[model samples]
Target: MQEEKRRGQNRDIDLDTLDGQIIRALQQDGRASIRDLAASFGATRELVSHRLRLLTEHEGLRVVAALDPGFAGHHVLTHSMVLVDGPVGPVAERLAELPDAVFVSMVSGAFPLVFESRHGSVEELHESLDWVRGLPGVQRVRVTTYSEILKGFFVSPERRQISLDSIDYALIAILQRDGRTSYRALAEAVHLSASSARARVHRLIDAGVIRISAIKSGGISRNRLAIGIGITARGGTEPIGRYLAVSPAIDFAARSHGNYDFVATLVGASSSTLLTVIDELRTIPEVGAIESWAHFDIVKEDYARTLGRVLGP
Candidate 1:
């Protein structure tokens, strides 16, 4: 395909079936060593490692840790849609700087900007929203409480009793920047032996404190589509939320309190496939209303990138 740039994104990178498989495996287990990935692919470790680097450095793929803030002392997660009457650029950038803001996107629709924030309590969330409402482009803000995070970017369900010390925090900081960093490199960076470094990573993963996964590139492509869906349920929201959680097209889903009962992100091969996924949601008897916004571009995704910033210098 000819390389085309849309909204500062290039869509011409060639990705073969092998590249796709590697990405899928990493998405499932970001801690998968090169040897392990090679075994799964029936290829050599050197070949696998080379392709991994190419994908990460050239194809916009990132291997990073996805932290569960709840495990790290955060208690509240809220999904917010900010409708602005002025230039969205400034407002979106301001939102991204909020201490609680984790994911921020400049999208197309009634709400030009959408973001998710985490806090230690309802009061904190309210304070943050109040501050946001007072921003210069101020118009209106809708805040929806996330009753539960059925499925987040790369957060897993399993939880473990674990304590994080300064060393552990440092390790997470390094891994958040490069999930596929070699054990020896990680050990050296954190002042530990290779074996010990590997053990700590496993403990973090098993405890569900952090998840390593591949973050796919974002760009408008003739072969790909991304959509944000707002769903309202009639009888109950859990069933529909769970349904979305298991859907192949769903990249993210959460049950919320507000104008919509549930929110989801879907990625498909084409517009027809996206519509098919919506039709499937409509078939559910509990579905009352659904609204979808096509994502024009994604400006920022924390994906554990801000953990170090949140933790301190």
Candidate 2:
């Protein structure tokens, strides 16, 4: 990650530990043998098996190889940052009600609300933006177009283990938009026959390139509070980012080039604990500036939102 940051690029998660082994292996090839992961971790398969179960039940982690939209013809991937002064729940709720909205956050950054809003086409995107631009509490929205995605996974970087092909890239882009793309249709799109396409998709699955699955969004815990924190690091982002990544309360954290330099998205069980976490973050020597935002409700959560135009059946 440090090397990637030096190059102004991103490093995929590392997958070397027992837990990382389980997450990455299962994410790409869901049916991987515990014995194999255990061997990689220098532990017994039973122990690895137990750890895997805990990761699922306790962490609520899903090793999903979600679809890519580019191949299925819904190619646009748009991100928007929003700012709001007052209660974000009301506005978040209203926005979340829309099936098209995805990945909503109330953070203390350049954009209070960052979304992976989608569109089937450029014309359609502009049309939808017309409505999103008018949403209440949305002080302003700046949209950025993502032409390509180098990497994405639900689990940490340590879990992303796979190789890709030209076809895999094209297939992922399509599946990002249309998760239900059939093997036959995929073959036709990528200039392969049905059999080859099916084999390639399965290989990509084993290699950890893409996944075909359903998108469900009801995992919110009433005990969990979404707290957005921005930390400015003096030594560099890696140390602080690693610190936040291992934190029990932190849910989604990233090193960004923006107002705070680094952002940590955490899930606090209670308000007091959340504040305590903030205090701890502030105490870190490298931290220069820290800002936080608390949310009462989450508007939207969809993995496919990255491809843009999140839609429902």
| Highest TM-score model number | 1
Off by over 4 Å in 1: 1-20, 34-51, 217-224, 305-313
List, residue by residue over 1-313, the lDDT tens digit for candidate 1.
2232231221333346457678767778877888788787666566677788888877778888878777655678877888999789899888878878877777778898888888878898889999999999869998777777777656678787877888888888888888888899999988899999999998888898898887766534443467888888899766797788898778788888877888888876678888999999999999999988887766667758466545553
**In the order shown, what is each candidate's alpha-carbon RMSD?**
6.3, 12.0
Error of 2 at 7 (Å): 43
Worst lDDT 10-window in candidate 2: 7-16
* Candidate achieving the largest lDDT: 1
Q: How many Å off is the CA of 69 in candidate 1? A: 1.9
What lDDT does each candidate get?
A: 0.79, 0.58
TM-scores for all predictions: 0.85, 0.49
Model 2 spans with C-alpha error above 4 angstroms: 1-21, 24-31, 154-209, 212-300, 304-313
Relative to the true structure, candidate 2 has a C-alpha RMSD (angstroms) of 12.0
After the best TM-score superposition of candidate 1, give how far the Cα of residue 174 lies from its true spot, in angstroms: 1.1
For candidate 2, report its TM-score.
0.49
